[model samples]
Target: MAEASYPEDLLYHPEHDWTKIADGVATFGITWYAQDALGEVVFFDPPEVGSSVTAGQSYAEVESVKAVSDVFAPLSGEIVEVNTALGDTPEAINDDPYGAGWMVKVSLSEESEQESLLDRAAYVASLT
Candidate 1:
């Protein structure tokens, strides 16, 4: 399992998703808390490129040793790229949820929605 971390540069959602915005694209992934609860990831089927994803919606599915969980979108956007490597080694989601475990890169559709996302401090507070 990876060490617990909530990067300061990323914005977090109450559902345990995170996004790092750069330009108009944002990279999305589940957080450490999320993967920890789900246990060792065994499968991940990502959304197709160019698919539209709405903020606060499930865009993909991840199967873990413990259970399968929906991977949520933290921002509304069109998927531009997906981490294809996860299909071969899903444990990356458990080992590095914030890095190689990142699920997708999206061309964000609604910038204003970002205002509602929490910072690392606030997200950690919400956990307790």
Candidate 2:
């Protein structure tokens, strides 16, 4: 896989969640690849603030014209904030998968878990 494939700075989950840590909190969202696969997102159901989420488990869901996809937690943690903007305009996800389309912030319970996820190179390779 080329360096230009997936965002190298983030961690990727097999289910398509990507997490970027900043100021000790991990911000998460679906990858561009995921949004493309889901197709024309129409709705997003984010977990409530302060909800506890386990690693490798669904914390939210996205409904698209094609199907519904679970948004998994990249790691075990408590959700601190959600991108409320997505609820009003879910298509933002397909238009900007890595920016304003971000889903939530999780106060990471175990920082070491970040090391276990796939990197950009590995994630792209996994696609094949």
Candidate 3:
């Protein structure tokens, strides 16, 4: 089956995060389908801004009524910013996972890792 939902502008990870490379930084967020599957988000434990994060490593956490889930880094980088809004209004994750609900922005320490991540179509294909 073909993918019903995949943003052409974003690169994706098998872990369900999406990255939008802008400027020299990459803005990232959880995909909509992932937010839905996680249920309602109530809290986020994101990495501190300026911290170095390694790809495929646990760098953040998302908490819902049911459980807390770890968010993995899709690429190695130093976090330049985190969505402070999610701290107060975690439900924004469900309401606008791709926009205002974005989790972090990082200055990529290595550009080569981007090639290893999936494009939108591949991400959707993996979901199947």
RMSD of 3: 2.9
lDDT of 1 at 46: 92
Q: Tens digits of per-residue lDDT for model 2 on 26-92?
A: 9999997888788889999989999999989999999998789898888988999999999998888
Which candidate achieves the best lDDT against the true structure?
Answer: 1
lDDT of 3 by residue, 12-122 (tens): 988989889977799988887788888889999878998998888888999999998988888889999999989898898888877888999999999889999998888
lDDT of 1 by residue, 55-99 (tens): 999999999876889988999989999999999988999899988
What C-alpha lDDT values do all the predictions have? 0.94, 0.87, 0.86
RMSD of each: 0.8, 2.8, 2.9
The better-scoring model by lDDT among 1 and 3 is: 1
Q: Which stretches of candidate 2 lie over 4 Å from their true place?
A: 1-5
Task: Please report the TM-score between candidate 1 and the true structure.
Answer: 0.97
Clashing pairs in 2: none
lDDT, model 2, position 71? 89
Off by over 4 Å in 1: none
TM-score for model 3?
0.93
